[model samples]
Target: MQFTKLGAFISLFSLISASALTFTLGAQEKSCFYIFTEKPRTSVNFYFAVQSGGSFDVDYAIKNPKGVIIHSDEKQRQGDFMINADEVGEYEFCFANGMSTFAEKVVDFEIKFQDENDIYKAKMPVQPNSQPNTHVEGMQTTIDNIDSQLDNLLKALQYYKTRNNRNQATVRSTESRIYYFSIFEVLLMVGMAFLQITIVQIFFKGSRKQLV
Candidate 1:
């Protein structure tokens, strides 16, 4: 089958940094996915990568429940693809070296989800009780959620959107610190001025009294 190649467009890149890839709990809106396209046709190519030192083999179909096999790369050309997701839902893509290898092989993939859309394919097969792949999918979900959070944070910083009153809170905190520090500085200067005046008066008073 002909997998959709990222249409006539600019080359895109999405890096799932170590921190961006791991978040076992908390928010579910953001997630990150690593995808490798042997013949990438769409910017939305979806796949998953391994964690830490363990390298993984590649598959050309959906390896997880929540994901979909949107396309498959048969040409067997592998490269990095960055995904920027705007919606949350099932996404599908795959990695395959069957055209070449069958042993303990290692491949890296990056999938970008714009909004809360978090779905990923697992390199290994599913388990009976615990899903080895679910964890990777979950990590991708967290990363996707982070994208949204990061966007909101950036907007707040840029004054685009005043979300969660974050901008106001930051301004208030900064103002409070500056105000207190300024008051303390002024008070210190005033005390020094008073001390100088008192010393001058004491010295002059002694001279005047002796003259009188």
Candidate 2:
């Protein structure tokens, strides 16, 4: 019973350590965050999206413990990456907003770490003995199923979030263009009206002078 409780506690702790964050980057500025790993060959999942800003894109890079660039890109609106930590140390993830001089970028990102040993332990078979063993096996199976479902749900939510962000950016861009076009059209109409009035006045004056 104590062992089962301890396993449950560890699972909960792992889930809680997975993190999501949102941040704003000013034009021509860059931001970075770090995660520490205690062992080599741990699986890391990284995800990022530009929630709002000009062009809906930003530059990003992932660096290993030794400052070696593992993955990088420019003008990317969103990305999902899975990497294995080859060394035990700090890993850096950075985002750059150098593409726009005045537009700020809103970015959302998540990082999750999976320890291979924990996974192996979770999959290990249990020795069959009494009712307690059977009960524990059933509980573990249920927990695994729940964890799988949660993972799928998280993916679905992320997809919807990206779609929503893109739609919002489109709407904002269209609205801004429409506003500028309307102002230009109004100014052009006013200018044409003034020109026509000036032409009519000149014609009438010339006719009077000719009569004189």
Best by TM-score: 2
Q: Per-residue lDDT for 1-212 in model 2, tens only?
A: 00011112221123234678777888998877777777788888888989899888999888898999999999998988799888888787888998899999889888887665564334535566734566677888887888789888998898898889889888989999999999999999999999999999999999999999
What are the per-residue Cα lDDT tens digits for candidate 1 across 74-132? 43323334443323433434334443332333333334432222234223334579845
- Alpha carbon lDDT of residue 38, candidate 1? 28
Runs in model 1 with CA error above 4 Å?
1-39, 44-166, 209-212
- Steric clash count of candidate 2: 0
For lDDT, the strongest prediction is: 2
lDDT of each: 0.41, 0.79
What shift in Å separates residue 196 of candidate 1 from its native position after superposition?
4.5
